[model samples]
Target: MAAMSKPYYVTTPIYYVNDKPHIGHAYTSLATDVLARWKRLEGQEVFFLTGTDEHGQKVEKAAQDAGMDPQSFTDRVSQSFRVLAERMGFSNDDFIRTTEPRHKAACQELWRRLADRGEIYLGAYEGWYAVRDEAFYGPDELIERDGVKYAPSGAPVAWVKEPSYFFRLSKWQDWLLRYYEDNRRFIAPESRRNEVISFIKGGLSDLSISRTSFRWGIPVPGDEAHVMYVWLDALTNYITAAGYPDESHPRWKFWPADVHFVGKDIIRFHTIYWPAFLEAAGLAPPKRVFAHGWWTNEGQKISKSLGNVIDPLALIDEYGLDPVRYFLLREVPFGNDGDFSRAALAGRTNGELADALGNLANRTLSLIQRNCEGKLPAPIENPHLMHDTTLHSGISDLREKVGKALEDQQFHSALEHIMFEVRYANSYITQMAPWALKKTDPVLMLQVLRLLHDALRVFGTVLWPFMPTTMDALLDQLGVPKDQRKLADLATPLPGGIPLPPPSPLFRKIELAA
Candidate 1:
């Protein structure tokens, strides 16, 4: 029997439309993009979805402040997110907007189903609410500072009491605990798992699922007087994108998403509230939810008040997309907090990209053009030589390790492994002194050139997912077929004596000013 095909379904948190796209949003999307691209390269059927969360009190207030209708405001701001995704090379298959009619229909259908199941009920809600966070807080979660009571934000919270509907979240606490205990990988990083377990152990509360105070969100089924809470409203986006509430819909085949890539701050909503919501509706929760860490700008938390929030578009415009993507994944471990700085970005691009990988390609291909008459020279087969054997064996090992790293979602490690091979190739060429060999023994020089070509071809194949355009250019210079550059071809050696083109410089060196 043939091996079964794997399915990969991934999502980034639907960004709230109250603010424009920022580095935080870009971070989540980029991480998901890398995963989706890698899985596709590995021959998995991938469904990647990302979109905007357009309905909330914060969005309403922001629209009002901007002197526009909520719909108009959201439309304009949401386009910024789409544009950013395209600019950053995101390959998401679907972009969902909560304001879309399809999503509204799905939300209404879900609400009715939960209501019919006796999971939703009317009640009064009075608590501290944060407009910025769109979250209701209990007394214990509040902090008092400077004679003002706040909901963990420095801004004072307004007291309001309103009739609302609630979800029986407390009734599902035992089930959630059992689910976590049985499925140890439900949350990520082990540390995040502990945090989530602690939060759930503190005791789950019946969640207020509807808000009578806000009229700017998805209206609750059978009750136009209230709208669904922002968390519930936002969490439904995953199923909405998969065409839920209409089981006959074609996209429903991808339901019960394989993975949801979210930020650590929102893990509770994804792990606790999202799973509970799915269970109440007789649906399966996503197979996994990986909550990744935050980023600070130059060692300080990004703050508009501090005037240091990083603009992703500006960074892309300044440094280019792949460099930004590479720096982000390479600079830090995936689940740990990282600091971003212009100096750090420049250093990695200059040292790893330009000097190491890029320069090696430039020199090797230029030598082929100048010394080998712009054609690949046939490699001399010498199984007895230790260096040749070692190079081949090392590349085969790298192929295996890179595949494992991608499977484990360790993109930084995968990229590091590829660059390590590049470094090895550069050193091999230097030690062999291929240029001198051309004068001493032309046949020996051809063998050395063949090794360089084979190394570059494999490097390009592994790198295609991370830096597509750059890798394509590198392969073109080596005269390798685009079709032959699939991920599975990493172990295959290029046929020698293929005509090559003069090497164009892959990356330019940058000088730091004194």
Candidate 2:
């Protein structure tokens, strides 16, 4: 595909500051980071934003429980998220806190727009509110568990009655359905799209847009007594980070985000409520909102209560970053729930990161260093291949194959094809017996080694978005410059005599205690 001339904007849902950073947060952010990196590599201008949602009743209560003011509490916890992003190598371009002056301005501007359009109205809200989710549910949507009510999502809910401001969410139901029908991709994963359609068909009630009981939020534009709904203030962070209320802002080109990467739990907000708010404000909805599935630990649900919320930092410390990142996209289909296991992580590290890509890089680079005078060898003009079509066909068609896979959001498939090439390289080396070729026909050995260099060039370059650090270091070892690391450079071979860095393993095996 030709490079996109238009800018690409992607976002991870602004995480709630009520909780600390976890693997679930890392999963969404990392997936978006990969997409942002891919778009930049594709030669498109990209804006990637992620940050904390610092308001809501849940946050207010959490702060009180922590014995601190809301701002101080959010500040402390939000820094953990920022630190997590930095340590995980997330390439987020902007991190917006809702409490920031810029974000407050954006939220108020949006609220005023909706209010002017008659989409906001004074009302009282009485419903079962899930403190954990910061969401309210209808009577029919609640379930009883041991004499306590819970949202369908299993979050505990308590009755909330307060003076509130309501958004005219019901008015947009038909329009939203039509939009979904017209766009077809407004919500991703056919299953998710179907679910939204069915839910909207069942009905959409007007949404509570302001809470009078909670003062720890962006106050409603004209009414100091009410605060903007956490969802409204939170969703506006997208445009806020895009420099909303200022068309001249350079990042405004990224309005109508290319994609909103969110978890399935929040699909209702993104697919329905967020679009309604944007349309009410006379703005276009984001191109897509893809809600990915959750991760369980070792076939059991991962939860704080269970003492099994996986700490992404600890995981990275135990296993290197690239392998951990690789395992995430590789182990699960992007939109489906996955199981996390130390055993699975260690196995993939040893098997693929260590045995396949890492082992292949060392073997090929070591051959060049020992046999080719520490430089790339000359390639034969047209050499006869002695191997089967399996690998050549795969390696040759890799760019288009992987590109299509990524475009389709088939991350696992893309990584699978990449590892396929790695396996093919290993098989090809064994088939040609490059070491033996060195003694029998040194010239043919050079051809095999050159072939290995070209093949590694393709896979390593393709692997960059998935495993940036490892691929960058691997490409550097192959003598490929950073400027030439785009998708267009995948099939391009290195010049014969570029000096190389000494080879080292890209990933290490994580040994588990026996």
TM-score of every model versus the real structure? 0.95, 0.96
User: Model 1 misses residue 487 by how many Å?
Assistant: 0.9
| Each model's Cα RMSD | 2.1, 1.8
- Model 2, TM vs. native: 0.96
lDDT leader: 2
- In candidate 1 the C-alpha lDDT for residue 133 amounts to 75
Q: Superpose all Cα atoms of candidate 2 onto the true structure and report the RMSD in Å to 1 decimal.
A: 1.8
Model 2, 386-453: lDDT tens digits are: 34445556777887878788776788998898888899899888888888888899887887788788
Clash totals in order = 0, 0
Off by over 4 Å in 1: 1-4, 152-156, 379-388
Model 2 regions lying over 4 Å from their true place: 1-3, 383-393
List model 1 lDDT by residue over 1-514, tens digit each.
Answer: 2212656789999999988888989998988887888777666778999999999888999999999999999999999999999998999999999999998998999899999899998989887877787777778878887777887545568776889899999999999999998888788878888988998899998998888766899998778999899889899999998888888877787888887888988888999999999998899888888888889998898888999989999988888777788889899888889999888999999999999999888888888888988888775466347356666666667767888887666778999998888889888889888889888987778777787787888887777777777778999998888777666655456667788878887766555566
